[model samples]
Target: MVVTFDVSPEKEGSVLNYFYRQLTQTPAEVRGIDLGGKTAIVTGSNVGIGLECSRQLLDLGLSKLVLAVRNVSKGQAAATELSKDINLNPGTIEVWELDYASYDSICSFVERTKGLERLDIVILNAGIMATEARINPSTGHEETIQINYLSTALLAILLLPVVKSKRPLAEQPGRITITSSDTAAWAKLDERNEEPLLSSFDKPGKVDMLNRTFVSKLLGQLFLVELAKRVPSSVAVINMATPMMVYDSEINRETARSLMGKIVEVFRRRIGYTAAVGARMVVDAAVKHGEETHGQYLGLQKLKPMAPIVYSSEGDHLRSVLWRETLEEFSFAGVEDILNEVNSDRKEIL
Candidate 1:
C-alpha cells in the first residue's frame, strides 16, 4: 500500500513531515563499493542534508572532497564532525568559499578548481527557504532564486567543462547530482506570478509558506530537464527528491523553538525519517548506472516520473528562458578564465 501521513492540517505545511514519515516506513535500497581516488564538490555542505550526503560519500572512500560553504568556520566544524565516523585523510576535505547569492563567488569557486587532477562528482545541494524581506544583494536577483536556482546553474556550467575533460577511470564517468523537492508537482514554471517568488520575502507579512515551497520545487525539476541536455554520456545529472520532514540534520532543534518550529518538530518526530536514511536516495542517484534511469526524477527510493504538467509547453519555455537568463547573469565566458586563475593560486587557496 502507498502510505501517506497527515502531519499538518495545511497541504503546504505537511510536506516536510509527510515525506519523512512515508519514506521511513519504506526506505530505498543502496548499492555501491569503493569510491577511492574520486572527487566531488558539494555546496552548502556545512550542515543538514549536505553534511549527511558528504558523510556517506566519505565513508565510501573518496580520495579528495571539496566542501563548498559560505562559512569557513562551519565548514571546518562539519568536516571535523564527519571525520569521526569516516577515515578522512589529512586535508582530504578541502573547504572552499562559495556564496550562492553572488555570481562572483560562483565564478571564483569554478575558477579555483580548474586545475583539479580529476572531478568525478558535483552535488548541487544548497538551498534557502527565507521568508524575510526581499533583498538581491549585489547579484541583482531575488535571494531564493539566486541562491537556489541561479547559483546552481552557474556551478553546473562551470563544472561541465571539467567533468567533460577528465577521463573516467575504469570506465565510470563523472556524476552531477542535485537535491530537488516534491513541490515541483505544483510548480507554475511557465506562469510568472504577479509577484516573483522573491517578492514574498520583501513583505514578510505577505509571505505564504506553501507558495514558496511549491515554486522552489518546480524550479528544481525544470533545471533537471534542461541540465540533462548538456551533460555527456560520461557525465550524469541526477535529481534527488528529499524527504520534506525528515528528522535529520535538515530539521534541527532550531526549528522547534517557535510555533511553526514546534509544529514542524512534532510532525517530524511523529512521522519523519532520519537524515541518514534520506541521504541514501541522494547517494544512490549519484552512483547508480543504466541509461534507463538517467535524466529522471526519483522519490521514496525509486524512479518516480515527474508529473505530466512538468512536461507541458510552459515548462519547456521556462526551461529555455531560465537557462539563457542564468548563463547571461553569471557571464559564461568568464568560467574558463576563473578556473584557470583559481588553479594558478592553488597553494594559498587550499
Candidate 2:
C-alpha cells in the first residue's frame, strides 16, 4: 500500500505542542507479549530509548539480548545496572562494541552476530544529532548523515541474513526496526534533482546541522521502503518508527547548546516524554506481529501516513536513487562483500 500524507513542514509551536501531548499523555502498557527463547540486538543500547527498549525486552523474558554500544565499558555498566531489577537469568544480557562512526566497527559487529542461532529482533537505535558541521573520517560525509543514515543502512542491510535465517525458528516473523523521527516530516530534499543528495553536504554552507538531521532521517525512512520491497514478509519484516519527542535523550543536549537553544530546551524538557515512555513506540514496533507493519512508517504507536513526497512519483525515483547511491557508497567503503553475503543469503531463501 502506498501511504501518503497531507503534512506540511511542522511549525515550531506545533512541534512543541506535539511534544507536550506525548509528555503529558499516559502511554498504553505492553503486556502478555512473551519474547522467550528469542535473541535480540539493540544498537546504541547503552543509554536512552535504546537502553529502555532493551530493558523492556528483557523484562518480557527474552532469552538473549545484545547491547551494541560504542563503549564496551559503558555497555557493560549499563547491562549491570539494567539487570538489577529485571530478575533475568545469568548472562542473559551481553555487551558488544559497535561504533557507527567506523565501518570496521560495524563490520566486526556483523561478523560477531554470525555466532547467534536465533536473531529475532534488531533495533537500529544508535544515532547522533551534531550541532556543528563535521565529517566522519571513515565515510567523509556529514557526521549526522553518516551515523544516522549511511552506516545505519549498511548495518541493517548486512544483518538481513542473520535476521532472515532465524525467522523460521521464531514464533512470529523476525523484525528489524529502524528508529526514525517525526522530524522526517520536515525533510525537504530536492526530489526532482537526480544528483546524489548526500554529496551536497560536502559543499560549504549547503546544508545546516538541523536540515542535515532531517534529511538523514528522511533518507533512513526511504531506505526502509526499498528494503521492504526487496525482502518478503515470510523472511523478515522491516519498518521505520518515530520515538516522538524524547526529551530525556542526549540529543536534547546536543541540540540545545546555545543560550537561546537552552531556553527552548527548558520547555522541551517540561513537555516531552521521558526516555522510558518514548521507548514504548520502538518496543511496539519490534515485537508487534503481522505483515501490516512491513515498510510502514509508525508514529504514536500506530502505522501513520508518511509525508506526501514518500508517495509521489518523485519520491519513488528518489528512493531508487538513494538505494543505488547507498550501495555504491558501501562498495567504496570496502563493505561490498558483506552486501554480497546478504544478497546471496536472501536469494537462497527466496
Candidate 3:
C-alpha cells in the first residue's frame, strides 16, 4: 500500500545527502549468514561486484550458485578462481550465460530456470552505463534504457512466477534483489513532460548519456513501485539494493576504459568500496531480509529511501506509463502467458 517514501522528490534529490552517504559507507553485515540449502543466480558474475558476490555466497554455505554472466568462458574462469579460494563441493557452482543486452538471451535464460528445483535468491547485478547514446539494434532503445531498465524489468517480471513456483508451500518467498543507485535521486527527468515518456527514451538524440544511467535507475524505481503492487510480498519478495558508488564495479569502468578511466579508477579506488566490500551489499540484499524487503530499497547496510521522485504524483504518472509500455514491449515474450500456465493463485497479469 506504500506508494513512495514520505520525502518529497525535490527535497530528497540533494547532492549533500549522497555525499553524506558516501562518507558513511560501511560493509554490509551478511558474513557467516546461514544459506545451506539455497540456490542463487547472480547476473554479470564474471567480474566486478557480481564475482565477489558469488564468492561471498559460497563462502556463506550457499549450496548452489549460478554465476549468470554474459560470457561463458569468463564465468568458467571466475568459477575456477573461486574454487581456488573456497572448498567448493563438486557442482556447487555453475556458470550460465545471460546477456541483458539481448532480449533473446534474457528469455532463453528464463526458459532454463525451469530446470531449477528451487530458487531461493536472485540478485540481478547485470547493468551498464553508456557514455555514448548508442541504440541497441535489437530493441532500438538507448543502451541504458535497453539493459538497465527495460530488459531488467522484462526479466524480473518473467522471473517472478518462476521464483515463486520454485518454493515450497511453507518456504519463505524467494528473494529478487536488483541493484539500484543513489544517483537516481539526482535525475531531473526533463523528459517527464513528454506525453508518451517511453518513446522519448527510444529516440537516440534525446538521451543525455551522462544522465541516462541515473535516469534509467529512476525509471527502474518507478517500474518496481508498480510491479510490487501487482505481486504481493507473499508471492515474491522484491527490492533494490544500492551499493552507492562502487568504484570497481563493472559499470564503473565500462565507460572509462581509456586514460581518463584509469585516472577515474584511482579516484574511485580511493573513495568507493572495493568490489569485495560492495559485494557485501549485494549478498546482504539476497539472504538477510524478508517480506519487509519486498518492494523496498536497501542501502548503506539498511533500508533507505528510493529515488527522489519515485513516489510523487510525477513518479506515479511515470511508473504507470513505464508499466504500460514495458508490459506491452514484453507482451511478445508472454510474461502473462508464463504466469497463467505456471501460477494461478496470483490474479494479476504481472
- Which candidate leads in TM-score? 3
Q: What are the RMSDs of all candidates, in order?
A: 7.5, 3.2, 2.7
Clash pairs (backbone) in predicted model 2: none
List the pairs of residues colliding in candidate 1. 16-244, 16-245, 20-272, 21-271, 111-338, 111-339, 133-201, 134-201, 134-202
lDDT of 1: 0.65
Candidate of highest lDDT: 3
Off by over 4 Å in 2: 1-25, 168-171, 190-194, 332-350
lDDT by candidate, in order shown: 0.65, 0.79, 0.81
Candidate 1 lDDT, tens digit per residue, 31-88?
Answer: 4668888888888798877887888888788888889999999999988888885656
> lDDT by residue for model 3 over 155-185, one digit each (tens)?
8988887888898888888889998887888
Ranked candidates (lDDT, high to low): 3, 2, 1
Q: Please give, for residues 129-173, the per-residue lDDT of candidate 2 as tens digits.
A: 878878777778878888999889989878877776666653566
How many Å off is the CA of 184 in candidate 1? 1.7
Report the candidate with higher TM-score, 1 versus 3.
3
Instruction: Provide the global lDDT of candidate 3 against the true structure.
Output: 0.81
